[model samples]
Target chain A: MTSAVLKPGLTPSRVLIYAVLILACLMYLVPLVVMLLTSFKTPEDINSGNLLTLPHVFSTLGWVKAWATVRGYFWNSVAITVPAVLISTAVGALNGYVLSMWRFRGSQLFFGLLLFGCFLPFQAVLLPASFTLGKMGLANTTAGLVVVHVVYGLAFTTLFFRNFYVSVPEALVKAARLDGAGFFTIFGRVLLPMSVPTIMVCVIWQFTQIWNDFLFGVVFASGDAQPITVALNNLVNTTTGVKEYNVDMAAAMIAGLPTLLVYVLAGKYFLRGLTAGAVKG
Target chain B: MATLELRNVNKTYGSGLPDTLKDIQLKIAEGEFLILVGPSGCGKSTLMNCIAGLENISGGAILVDDADISQMSPKDRDIAMVFQSYALYPTMTVRQNIEFGLKIRKVPKAQIDQEVERVAKLLQIEHLLARKPGQLSGGQQQRVAMGRALARRPKIYLFDEPLSNLDAKLRVEMRTEMKLMHQRLKTTTVYVTHDQIEAMTLGDKVAVMKDGIIQQFGTPKEIYSEPANLFVASFIGSPPMNFIPVKPAGGRGRWHVPLATDLGQLSLPLAAGDADLDQRELILGLRPEQLALAAEGDSAVLQARVEVTEPTGPDTLIFVTINGTKVCCRLAPDLAPAVGEMLKLSFDAGKALLFDAKTGERLARESKTPAEGSAGNVAQFRGR
Candidate 1:
């Protein structure tokens, strides 16, 4: 019995951790369960029935209507998010490689400015940036939303790549240089191959940020190009008609699926990168 | 094979920072192994970086085969370096790690495979070829790191304490393997280490460095037998050479040094005409192996009380007080002496060295061996 507690298979510490994890999972599942139950109910049933009770009849009507209500905006969100994450991560990796390896005057200052931008409040520049987008004829378009997300995500993506690149031994770079690899060769062959873990974090982080972004879409996207976040707000706020709680909850779940799938797929790298950064120094 | 030269190389971290490597001028012959030995912060690694083109020299030219390579990028410089941390690409299998350089250079696929096989076999790491660096032991990782360098046919190789992370027994094994590998390849290599034994046994020429300056550069035998100053003497040996202080006594033609110990004052004969005799105060340099228990009459025997004895399987180190300084004597294991016993010791006077007590420079002299039984009953005192 004592040995059982000492063994990792069913140790007391392991049992306690498992219990807490189960509780946390239930806590997270509560809101999702409520949303799912409400989505299956008729508008009156959603307002009048016990939330925990099983429905006498289940229907796909809520999903059908939710798909129709904001389908264009959901497609727009995907269109903007995909390109924005790719652009931000690509540019950030290049900047990170140069900053980490090369020693030039003002390199420190450049990095300092980039780091400073990461902590700046998004609201502080929103008005002026929106005005600039208007002047540049990028306002009220999917491109405009993409630009905003890319700008906001650049600092974080660059930091991830920069820290990862710095951990690569300088000797490897030198060896590559002696082997006739120039700047691009070293990046392509050495740094890039060694950076899978960091890249996974970058993609997952920037994808989630761009997908869930409400402010950028609300300010920049218009009409047919509005993202799911903006459309979901519209669906909730249209006061002239009866509010459809079932469709609203279903639409919200549909809008959240992309980020959740990405998180699950890349969670290993995301957590590993974070823990490695803490200990590698 | 190529000759390399660093002509007045200078490296400073920043504009106002003190120079890490200052006006370092060196020439390494083709197919020679040059070992850089120094304490930490002595810029040995920095020098290796400059040679590998990893660190840019602030001033001066680096020439390979008499052509200036100072401005050449590391890739074009044709040098390979094995780092202190091994720096194995953690994600790559050992086979890929060895193939990386060849792949970068666009070597033929079939030939790359053959070269990898060769190095893996040579380093006896063929079995680890499929494993990642993390899965292998430290000693195995070190061999893979060396295999990576061996896969490249660069003009020179730089090793920065490559075996420092291994266990003591493995380090000794690798040290012998490295010597044998160097002998076979005849490659021009620069190895940096603080281990004096490695420096002594590995290099064709060893440079003793201190605070960014090369104190002396010569064969290990020369550096050992004729050290440039007190620092080299103190730094180069295990159990280090003992430095005993003394004052010149008696008149001309018969110079003697008065050693004051807890046992009593005894006069040790100095080689006549030793230049440092004029200085009055001098330091006597003796290797621990040179001192022995005096069993026969000897002219220059000094009596001291043994304080401690350490017995290893091969030899025993007996510690005694001489001229108020603790001196260690390496004696055969069977010739153990008791603690607190008065022991008369004899040393070959011909091998005795005298130094300036102030400047610590060696005093020039022709030393004569002590005549057995000529200096009378001094060796008869095993009395205590």
Candidate 2:
């Protein structure tokens, strides 16, 4: 039996706290459990039993069909997220380095403008972003989606990196400058090497965000070029074919798995990176 | 080894703001150690930064080797600096920290290794080469910071209070080490510090600054013995210079400053050139060591009751109320006075300085030998 966190004995408040926590956990876990169970069931079994019930017969048919349906779009999501995440993170680091360390006239105001981009709702940029992509001859392409994600992802990534870099002593840059290290050299050696935690935060954040992004994916790309989120939406919402709940559940699970795995593997660093700047002197 | 000259250097944050460094002028010969000493926010560090090319000067020029470097970037200036915080690269090991500068300047791989080894051995950190800054103690980190600056044979080195963070014992140890290092390297160096002892001990030339202006620039002895003004005199002494106000008097023709002692009033005569001091408040500046116990027959003795006694091992400090202000006198430990004992004090008359109380500027004139008749304080007290 797990003991209460604050007191070893089973106090009434401790019991009440654990009760509220367990209920919260179940509220989140229940949907995942339902998805997990339904994904393994045949459509007939899914209809016959409720969300929690075990399948009468476990079948690979749903898994096979979901993979067949979303396989191409998964690769597209990878293409969009991989380049988008890397480019956005690298640009953000440079932006952060300049903003925090090599400040020029109006740099703070520029950063203020850049930060304004972080608060901008994605819906606000849809029309202009589409127009720009169309002008660049990138409409309805994976390249267009990648560009959209990178442009959108930059605000948050820069915010993360800038906040982290601000806590780094300006003396470090001064010392580096006196050591004969120029701007890029200082960033590469003195700063970027010390930026691993923030990098982890940026990569994980951008990866999951871009992978799960359906708005830009749907707006910028079309048909076969749609990301896994768009593909999953299409697969789940179709009314023309008989509603296959099992396949729909499996497809949704498949689309969500990469982000889930990324979180599970690196969740500790993401949280650690966010608080590292705040607690540091 | 290079000579550094700051010619009419002026810096301001913006058009309307007061200058951070105002019309600063200084020159140090090759291999000289120059110290900029002052209190916090005195612009010593800012001047050092301007010298290092980290901060731009709004006017004037900095020359290294007699060439203008004010327009050059820090990298192009060939200057090295050790920050007060050490500023050691946190991610790099000791070796990498030392190697970084050489590698950035594109020195050969073999030369980089050789340079790192040289600095490591010189700083006595050969064993710490593999360890990161986080794993090192404060002193060790400081050594690595020095090692990084020393790795390159730069024209000039700037140290911005590099040892201020260490414990007292270590700070003293480092002060000696810094002087020794300068003697060996003989590079033109500029150092900034608030601690007067470090300024006195380390610099071949000391510049005492306050409020962004260089108040006095001279050798340690000159700065100590002939401080340009009240601030410099007060700032450069350990138990800072005692500044006692000279009591203003009613009879103006004689210009004798009055001091009320336990025995009687002592009148000090001012010269004809000091006639201007008659209308204003006057101050007398004397070092604690300048005050000594009066011999029985001494002429210019201050008679007062001792208020406190502090025996600082090397010397004893006896505090007495003189002219209503607490005054400190340094005497031999064996002659330590008991608290509340009445004591007779006499100061070196020639070295005594007078200042205008309001402006805090030294009132310079030929030495005044305080009238010998004032010594009657001891005789008067004894007779009573």
Candidate 3:
């Protein structure tokens, strides 16, 4: 008798949700499908408006030529992103620990300034940042791009973890203090271990930002140091031959894959980390 | 083992705000269990936090073993606190949480494991070692929290309403376990709780506080029977000590307290040394259990209409009116009286207390000469 109600409870929400979800999923997938089909097509197939069709002759030439000519820029993206995520996450955690636990004069002011960084548009800072990087001898190198990624990433990552660590009961920290743990000890042993979800969120967010960056690479990097975003743009709109849309699509997918895998793997915690201290209490 | 003495300690959040702990003076002997009992926001938790070094004292010295530790960091205080929320590291398993303190102290891994196992077994959380705090029930979580503190073997243990979150049966069981553990360990401990029964049963000495000031500091029995003031008297008892405002109508030689009820005027006997009676405003404090059904002729007997009767299995609480004030009489379950019926109640005047109604100060006078045969075990109830 209870199963009668339980049946609808389980099946109704799932049925309705899955129905709408599948339709939504298809809508999202259509663009990516079109992009992939274009990436595989010859310039003629793309111009002919046969965009969503399979290649008449399946070709790896676009992939081969793109990899040979444009793969360094892809490597440049990896170079910029990996170090950027690592540096920003490490610094952000420290910033969060300080903001959450310690009380000092102007600590709140400093945090307010960092939060303000999140609201500022990249376009507003682009000219000055470019000039600053050039003056600092980091203009077009992977290091310059890394510095930019880390700068922008810091605001979001610090804000993410600052709020995360704030909800960790102050009593636990006090208990640790009475247990003979110092500030760094508590942060390393207690706060850091509990910050897995928040760290994953920061890492995924920063990885996507740095990996999918077009503006920074365009403004900063002039040559071989340009990232895959620059490379993908160049592939689609080069001055030489007609664009290889299939290769462009594939490269875009490849550049986006790291963040996709991150979300797919740690998606549950990512969602949890985003909405912590909401209903969980 | 150490003697903890708070000498004129005062804590204020800010200059303009009232003090949270006002000129608090207490001396707890080595291995003595001192229970700070008070209502919420009465500064019991604040006192505990100050003692644990979690909160800083605004004035005076807090000495442990004759050494001032007011400025010491919480880590240097050798104190372990079991918080009201349990405050177990939610991410860690029971075993890990217990071992955290030992690990911080750089204890050898083997010793940490052994100590963790010992406390886990003592708390009966051995089977829960692998489980996270979220997996455990509230009672189990409370045990693990206690285990974390016990693993440290610190100079003193502080419990801030540790069992308050548990259900009734579990709270009673935990109370018993706590008493037994204190007996076995003999660790100097200070516990803060609002439950008067817990305060009465657990502590060698109890400090009752109200509005940031210690109302009375004495053994549980003392606080119960000879509360320093009207507030303490009223706060300590279960159905609560009934306070009936009375006036000293007659001169000292006559010594009378006038009753102004429908039952007719009755003049109760008063003690000789009630100097505050000159003001004609005094409060009569009668514990519910002290008032009894007048079986036969008894001293200080009065007849009043029973307005309410509550039979609570073991005893019946009978409410009656005396001089326009509601008075409670605790009678045996078999002696339940019908509501609206006139019930004659008697009280031993020796058990009654007089307080200055305006100031809430005790009159501090012996009511009657001790009975010849009944030398009075009542003093035993004073300062247990």
Candidates, DockQ: 0.55, 0.85, 0.74
Write down the lDDT of every candidate, Cα atoms only.
0.83, 0.85, 0.83
Q: Put down candidate 1 lDDT per residue, A1-281, tens digits, no spaces.
A: 88966766777878999999999999999999998988887877776778776655786788899999889888999999999999999999998999889857999889889988799888887998899889989989888888888888889998998888787777667656765678897788778877877888999999998899888888777788889998999987888788888888889989999999999999889888776556663
DockQ head-to-head 2 vs 3, winner: 2
Arrange candidates by lDDT, descending. 2, 3, 1
Question: What is the TM-score of candidate 3?
Answer: 0.92
- Chain B alone, candidate 1, TM-score of 0.90
TM-scores for all candidates: the values are 0.90, 0.92, 0.92
RMSD of each: 6.6, 6.3, 4.2
- Which of candidates 1 and 3 is the stronger one according to lDDT? 3
Scanning candidate 2 chain B in windows of ten residues, the lowest lDDT window is B375-384
Question: What residue pairs are clashing in model 3?
Answer: A38-A245, A38-A246, A39-A245, A39-A246, A40-A246, B222-B383
iRMS per model, in Å, is 2.2, 0.7, 1.0
Residues A49-163 of candidate 3 have per-residue lDDT tens digits of: 7667787766666667767766787788888999999999989999999998875789999999999989989899999999989899998888998999899899999998898
- Tens-place lDDT digits, model 2, residues B1-384: 899988999999998888898888888889999999999998999999999988999999998888999999999999999999999999988898898888889999999988888888888999999999999999999999999989998999999999999999999998899888888889889999999999999998899888888887777877787666788889998898898898555453456667776666566555425345546778888899999998988787767888899999999998887788888889999987898888778767667777778777666554432222222111000000
Runs off by more than 4 Å, candidate 3: A1-25, A41-49, B272-276, B366-384
